[model samples]
Target: MLLLLIFGIVLLPKASTLKCYECSSDASGSCKDTEKQCPSNGYQCAALRVTSYAGASKVSDINVKSCAVAEQCVEGSLNFGVSRTVITSKCCTSDLCNTQLAPAPAKSTPNGKKCFRCDGQTCSGTLNCEGSEDRCMTTTVDVAGEKITMKGCASKVMCVGSETAQLPGGIGVGLSCCQGDFCNSAISTRAGLLLRVAPLVTWVMFS
Candidate 1:
C-alpha cells in the first residue's frame, strides 16, 4: 500500500493539468436592489475547485441571492431579488498542459490522411499522417481562444484536456500542444521516473 501511494505521488507530477472550480452562483437568498447585494450588503463571491486529478481541472459556479421587505404595506409575495455568478478554473501547470491530458482528437481525414481532432472553447484543430509507416503527414492545432495554432512541417501534435488562456497569466502557455506534461517534463519525469516506478507499484498492488 505504501509503495502504491508513493507511486501515485510520483505519477501525480506527470498529470497534464490541474482541476479547479469556481462558483457560477451563490445562496445568499434575494436582495431588493443591486446595492442590497452581498457586495453592497456585505457579501463576496464564492471560490471553489472541484477536482485536480489525471491532469484535469474543473470549476463550479454557484448562485447567491438576498432579499428583504422594505415596507409592511408591500404584498408578502411582491419582493424578490437575485444575482448572477461566474464560474472559473485556475491555471493547471506542471502536469496539466498541452503536453499532457489534452482533449481527445476528433477522428477525421485531412489531406487524404487519417488523424484525430478536437474542438472547444478557444480551441480547434486536426492531426493527420501520410499512410501507415510514415511519420505524421499533416497536423493543425488552432487555439483561437489563445490566438495561436500549430501548422506546417513544424506543427506539433497533442491533446488538450483543459483551456489555459481562461486562467490568469496562462494565455502564454496556451501555445503548447501534446498531452501528459510538456514533452520536456515527460522526457525527464514520466519516461525517466514515473515509468520506472509504475511497474513496481503494479507488482506490489496486483502481483
Candidate 2:
C-alpha cells in the first residue's frame, strides 16, 4: 500500500503542446503612411492582416488573420512549398516614425490544426500561453512507476493518513499521503486536559 501510494504521487499528467499556430510575413512592397496605433488609443502599434492561401492541395486558399503591437510586432512565417506568401495591409497607430512596417504575408498550412468542437464551430487557441501559471504546475508532475522519497524535520507530533483516488481514464489509481503535525499536537493537548480533570472528578465523588 505504501509503495502504491508513493507511486501515485510520482505519476500525474503533464501538459504539453498538442498543436501550434504558425505565422508568417511578406516583406515585398514599399509603404507610405499607415496608422501606428489603434484608433481607440491605449494600444500602441496594433495591426491586423488577412492572408489567403492558394495551392494545389486539400489545404488550399486558407485565410489567416493576425495582429500585434506595432512596437513589438510578433508575426508568423513558415516555408512549406514553392509559394512564399506575404503578410500586408495592417492597421497601426499614429506613431509612424517609431512603428516598423509589418512583416510580409506568408503561406502557412495547418497540417496538425484541430477543428473546433463547439456548438457551431471549433477553433484552436489563437494565442500561445508562454508565461501561464498552469503550464508551470504541469511541469512538476512526475512519471508513473517512479519512486520519490523526501525527508523533512517535522515539528510536534505527526497525524498520518492516506487517501487514494481513481486516475483519469480509469486506467490506474492515485494516492496522496498526508501527515499533519498540528493535528497530532491538538489531539495530545486534549488528551492531557481530559486526564487532569478525570482524577479531580473521581476524588470529589469518592470523598
Candidate 3:
C-alpha cells in the first residue's frame, strides 16, 4: 500500500507542460512576445484578435497571444448599428504554437434578421443582424458603479457559457438571448449612447 501511494504521488504532475506565447497588446496590429509556461493543465496556445468599428469605418484592432482554455477558443461578434466589435481566435495544442496573430473576422452582410438596439434613451431602434448573427442579445453590465445596458445582434457562439467572460470589463452582466426577429425587447436606460460607442479596451476584452 505504501509503495502504491508513493507511485501515485510521483505521477501526479504532467510528463510535459505546455508553453505558449504571451502578449497582451491593445495596439491595432500584430504583436509578438516571448514564450512562457502555461499557467496550468488543460491549456492551449491561442492567438486572438478583436476589432471595433464605428459604422463602416474601422476604429481599433487589438491582439493577444497566450494560454487559453478550450472554452476561449471560440469566435463571436456584437453589432450595434453605430458600433460593433468582432472577436476572432486561433488555437493550437502544441508548445509555442501561437506564433502568428489571429486573422481578422470575415466581412458579413446583413442576414435579414432584425433586433432592437439602444442608442439614446429608448432601446427601440432596430438593427440588422449580420452573418451568423442569428440571435438577439441584450446585456447589462455595471461600469463605474453605474448599470449600463446595451442591446444588439450577436452570434450564438457568444451566448455559450463563460466564452465571453472577458468582454465589457468582465463584470457580472445580466444577459438574455433569443431567436427570431425582434425577440429581444428594449430596456430603457440612460447609458444607451455610452454603451453604443464605448471603446473595446475600456471594456478590457483581454486579460
Candidate 4:
C-alpha cells in the first residue's frame, strides 16, 4: 500500500498536464493542428503572432503555437524608424486550447516621441516612437569580445520583467529601458520584468 501511494503521487503531476497544439508559421505548412502534452510543472497552451512592417507596407507575419509559461502571454511592440514589429500572445490551461491563431496587434501611429536607433556602429540616428512605444530600449551582448548593441523604441510591456527573461545566447545582455527621448543613449536600466520573448528579439535584431 505504501509503494502504491508513492507511485500514484509521482504519476499525479504527469497525468494533469495539458495537451497543446505546437507549430510555427515560419516552417512551410507547419501550422497543421497537432498537439503536445505540456509538462505539469507550469506550462500552458500558447499562441503567438508577430507582424512586421516597413514604412507603410506590410512586410511579414509569423505565427507560433506551443506550450508557454505565464510570463510569455503578453503583448508588446517595437519601432525603429522605417521598421517596426508587433507581438501578441495568448495562453490557455486546457488541452489543445491553442487551436487558433493569437490576435494580431493594431496598426501603430507616431506619437511624437523620439528615441535613438543604431546604424552600424553609430548609435545616433533619431527614431520616431509610435503607439504604445513609450520607452526607449537597448540591448548589448558581447560577441567575440566586441560588444554588439541594438537600440530602439519599445512598449512598456516589452520592458517589464525583461531582466529575468534571459534569452539563450550564452552571453549576458545589458538590457535597458527608459522613458524620454534618447534615454537609450546611455546603456543602463532598472531591472524589472518578463516575457521570455526569444523569437521576437532575434527577429528584430537580425531581420
lDDT of 1 by residue, 88-201 (tens): 222222211212111221221223432222222211233333212111211222332332222211122111223322222222133333322112111111111211121110
TM-score of each: 0.17, 0.21, 0.82, 0.74
Could you tell me how far off, in angstroms, the CA of residue 11 lies in candidate 1 after the best superposition? 54
> Tens digit of lDDT per residue, candidate 4, span 32-97?
667688866688888877676666665667777887777667676766554667777788988887
Model 2 stretches with alpha carbons more than 4 Å out: 1-30, 34-40, 56-94, 105-207
| Residue 179 of model 2, lDDT score | 33
What's model 2's TM-score?
A: 0.21
User: For residues 55-150, could you state the per-residue lDDT of candidate 2 as single tens digits?
Assistant: 232222222222333322233221111111222334443333323443444433343222111011211112111111011000011224432211
Best by TM-score: 3
Estimate every model's Cα lDDT from 0 to 1. Answer: 0.21, 0.22, 0.76, 0.66
Q: Best lDDT goes to which candidate?
A: 3
List all candidate RMSDs to the true structure: 24.0, 31.1, 3.3, 6.9
Higher-lDDT candidate of 2 and 4? 4
